[model samples]
Target: MDTRERLIESTRELLWERGYVGVSPKAIQQRADAGQGSMYHHFASKEALAAEAIGRSAEQLRAAAETQLSGPGTAVERIGAYLRREREVLRGCPIGRLTQDPEVMAIPALRAPVEQTLAWIRSRLARVLAEGREQGEFSSRLDPDATAAMIIATLQGGYVLARAAGTTEPFDQAVTGTLALIDANVAE
Candidate 1:
């Protein structure tokens, strides 16, 4: 990879592994195998680089979600595919983890991508649910917007629960339960 790409990728990994406060420019330089001059030449500051890295992470997250969400299937089936997709559950959601970082949340530039990405996911899910309702796959009682938010909550909370217990069981259970709930709501 080019020096710029290396720096961004290194920052992305560090940010995911070590929250905002824990990551340092020196650490990023070493991980990227680039020097201080190269980093400064690419990014004006640590926060600037972090913002770029976070934005890239958010873009990847959105694209991944879109893959399962927009794939051919019933709404619930598509959502189930999304929830069940393989993930590094122990590592937690990259963007979601950033919400816990005081520095990231305190900085609007760093937080914007995280916020926008989540909102987009929620909105996309809601659209899928709404389409399912229109297609008679879901009952009229199903609230697309509310259920979309719930799905996101369950996923994010599952990560926290799994990390707290140092296992992926909690996350697995959360996803299973969520899929069951969605299935239960299918039109009779």
Candidate 2:
């Protein structure tokens, strides 16, 4: 990869692995195999580079989710597919983990992409839930907005629980419980 791409990608990995406070410019330079002059030449500051990295990660997350949600399936089926989609459970969600970073959230520029990505996920899932309800795939009483929030919360919380326990089991369990709830509301 070129210098700029490598720097951005390196920053992305470092931010995912280390968060804002833990990742340093030296670390980014070393990881990207770029000199200090190269990094400064491409980006004005660490915050700027970190923002690009986080934005890239957010876009990837949105794209992956859109594939599952937009493909052929009932609303519940699509949502189930999304929930059951393979993930690095132990590593946790990159965007979700940033929510725990005080420094990232404290700065609006650093936090916008994370906030926007999560909002998009919840909104997209809500749309699918609404679609399922309209098609009689799910119960009429199921609130799409609330259910969407719950699903996102469960996935993020599952990551935290699993990371804390040093296993993917909690994450898997969370997915199972969420699927059960969605399944329970399936139209007979």
Candidate 3:
């Protein structure tokens, strides 16, 4: 791969494996197999490179979610598909994990993509829930905005539970329970 591409990819992995504070230009260059001059040539600073990489990761996350949300199925089924979609559970949500990092949370440039990506997810999921409500697939009592926010929280929280326990059972249980709650609310 080209130096620029290599640098970005390396940073992405490093960011996932280690938080923003843990990453350094020298470490990135070593991981990318690029020299200092090459690294500097493509990016002005480590934060700039990280911003590009985080943005790319956020876009990928959105695209992956879009696939499930847009797929042919009822709203619950689409959401269930998203929740059940295979993931590296133990590794945790890339963007969500970043939120726990002080550096990422403190910097606007670092945080914007994470914030926008999550907001996009919540908005899109809300749209689906609203559609379901309109079609009478969901109970009239269900609030789309609240339900969407709960789903986001549950999914991300599941990752934290699973990672903390060093087992996937917590994540699986969360998904199943969330789905059961959704299914229980189905309109007669």
lDDT of 1 by residue, 1-188 (tens): 99999999999999999999999899999999999999999999999999999999999999999999999889988999899998999999999999999999999999999999999999999999999999999999999999999999999999999999999999999999999889888999
Tell me the tens digit of each residue's lDDT in model 2 across 15-127.
88999999999999999999999999999999999999999999999999999999897787788889889898888998999999999999999899999999999999999
Off by over 4 Å in 1: none
Ranking by lDDT: 1, 2, 3
Which wins on lDDT, candidate 1 or candidate 2? 1
* Residue pairs in collision within model 1: none
Q: How close is candidate 2 to the true structure, as a TM-score?
A: 0.98
Ranking by TM-score: 1, 2, 3
